[model samples]
Target: MNYPFCIRCGWVLALTFASCYPGLAQTPTPARDTSFTVYSALAKARKTDPSITLARPAVPTIIRSRMNVPYCTASGRALQLDVFYPKARRQGGYPAVLLIHGGGWRSGDRSQHVPMAQQLAARGFVAVTAEYRLSTEAPYPAAVQDLKAAVRWMRANARTYRINPKQIATWGFSAGGQLAALVGTTNEETRFDSLACNIGYSSQVQAIVDVDGILAFIHPESGEGDDRKSTSAATYWFGSPKTERPDLWRQASALTYVGPHTPPTLFLNSSVDRMHAGRDDMMRQLSQFNIYHEVHTFPDAPHPFPLFNPWFSPTLDYTVAFLNKVFSRK
Candidate 1:
């Protein structure tokens, strides 16, 4: 139940002050110091297992990629995404998967998942890595809305990308995993939809891949919002401690929306227990509805296992298998 705290106490105090003063709230909130990048995560992982190394990005000749493609304009910012697809197209189109990075909703970028996207593309799938407004730029629902927008963009430009609009899935790591779950579960829910881009297109994903992400922010197994020790990433994103804004805490949880409409989910987790918060409850609901779900946990693996060698291969295999099963792709 011991997760590393990311945001400092001073940052939380400043946010608190901004919330109190109406005039000060209009002023731009200064960005917090977020150093959680792929290299940083690899460094931490190496300390535990020297054999672990960073996954470098590469574009194979068989895989075609388009970088910095604008997907949507939100909060006066142009949210962009990177696309990786196979050079050889299928008759209709290929199943697509949107890759989302994890950095406690504050750090990390679309490039973090470039390697995975390329690999998926080479394996007969259309893959995309997208950028969203972080908590430092915008909080909570903004990231969720941006992700849904990315889904709609994929469908809007389906012919151009040779993507099967009906076979789109979402795969996310850590915080991104949580966002993916939320977007997948809340399909057709107007509240999370943005009119920014691809207005008439749907944002629904057919499947979800959650890797080391918590399903509920305020669940019994959750370590978020424990501000008495330090400001957690969840606290910063919600702009309030769990005690002060329990409503928002519960509202943002993917567990809140899991029902008959929820899509099949695949969970790839580490040995970390707290990271699996609300997962059991979610699987129970899925079983009640007879919605297919799968889970795989790496023994003693770090939370960022997807970014390293030993775990990365298996993670990719599991993901491809799950998506193939869901989308009926070979």
Candidate 2:
């Protein structure tokens, strides 16, 4: 089938599904280099909506700058990942954190998550910020596949990057948070089994840091949410609406996959976001699974607040501490 084209950028996006597992020669295609610059995009997004603001770190980076690297291939398309690691501390391999960006599975870029990635890296972890296939080009699990491939790629190249292959964590904001939760909750016996290049390493994350990400597609309310927008996210990430694609929706839901072995998780949100129901539902599920999790509900923080404003720093501090605690253990 012919690939689709982006309306704004006129970028041709191929949607073919060939195995992107390691060892296969990557099918090459035109590189998508038009990703939004994180700083520029934030400034523009804030201009349209003053509620959004970029939060800067109080101190300078103790780590090296970003490393732009391609982590996956799909339909001849190359998806890139950016790595932020410590240049000063190189004696030992660091615990790793993969930062996924949120764009409703449609927009946003790796740069948007660079600050958080750098923050983690500066805190003694190898930070990997990745790009995935967007909904505008390919729908459903393509983005998930991109994330899976990134995990595989990181494991494959661990030594060179000074990373501990097993000490990996996935953290995301919004849609990316959902993806991180998906990685945290899923087991090797599920669909992800086929994608694992070798059983020696696992993609199960040590912890999941979710920032206002959706947990379940089974919206308890009827006609309450902006169906037009919500369904767009569901359809773009699950290939169909929750009603029509119950099975796939169930499979895709991170909440549904939580079990006794689920990695510990942290959720940050505010009362303003409509994800309260989903978040509550996820908490209940996690409780049932006996999973360890903590939720920080900012009084009036908006969605994507951490990346947008200074008020979100406390949450980032919590994230660094959470990483330190989780990685410090066996």
Candidate 3:
């Protein structure tokens, strides 16, 4: 018997089984390059502005780190994360933040954010840098599921890491920023949670830090599906052009999930307007719900400003202040 499959994700839709067990059918892995890194981003950014330099990872003596800790297993692969915390812990445990890297969803790894994580750790937060399956390995929801699983893992082992699980935040840059916003906005939404990891723990985050991440793939300001020249990153992740798989594009958008329950968010954007897609709308929704939020745009900064020096310091400062303000109230 020929079974129906989802054209968007290439998952076989065994209707009877899928309805009963939503997480049973995993997204098919696709062949793609995963070479984009902090160096690659720096190289590209330097072309536009030669003054830009890559942020090097530096573990201060005041910070303690555990490298390559397994967070969860997905599709028979162990997803690992690196944890950085202060040697001097807070009384009720330090607030935590998960840092995600941006590489258009096709490339980039957790190590890209190590510098920022170490800085956060030194500044009094338990920072975690996580590796999520990219578009090359699995499409769309796989990255989201992996990130949520990481949050669950953090919560489950909060005591061991000296983390205040209730005061966690998700922070991302570019593609990661989008994922961070999606994870923060979709709090308590079990559909995105994976059954294979930390089943009883919550993936809820108290704050979100989106640095130059597009909030919507289908919004008017979005340049996601304009692939006349070549296949766009959104196309690669969704496994189809936005025109063909608009449902997937919409579903993956963090704006689609914004509502009263959405947590306070900090939007650190560059001069690129396209990167700000759905941000204003999301802010409007948050305002309607009386939620706390902040937006700051560096006048002429590039999209990867979070990875460079002049802008990186301010980016870190804004993030620290936002997380402190949001968690201080709690």
CA RMSD, predictions in order? 3.3, 6.6, 6.1
* TM-score leaderboard ranking: 1, 3, 2
298: Cα error in model 2, Å: 1.3
The lDDT values for all models are 0.84, 0.67, 0.83
Candidate 2 lDDT over residue span 68-91, tens digit each:
676666747677888878776555
Cα-based TM-score, every candidate: 0.92, 0.80, 0.89
Identify the runs in model 1 with alpha carbons over 4 angstroms from their true place. 1-17, 20-33
Over the stretch 1-330, how does candidate 1's per-residue lDDT look in tens digits?
Answer: 223444333443446537832222333435543568888888888898999977764667898989999999976768899999999979889999999999988788888888899999988999999999877676677899899989999999999999999999999999989888888989858898865688899999999999988899888899887767756778767776778778988888999999998999999999988887999999999999999999999999999999888888899999999999988832
State the RMSD for candidate 3: 6.1
| lDDT tens digits, residue span 236-272, model 3 | 6666677766888988889999988899999999999
- Compared with the true structure, model 2 gives a TM-score of 0.80
| Residue pairs in candidate 3 whose N, alpha carbon or C atoms collide under 3 angstroms | none
Specify the highest-lDDT model's number: 1
Any runs in candidate 2 off by more than 4 Å, and if so which?
1-52, 58-61, 89-92, 193-201, 221-231
Give the per-residue Cα lDDT of candidate 2 at 167: 80
Q: How many backbone clashes does candidate 1 have?
A: 0
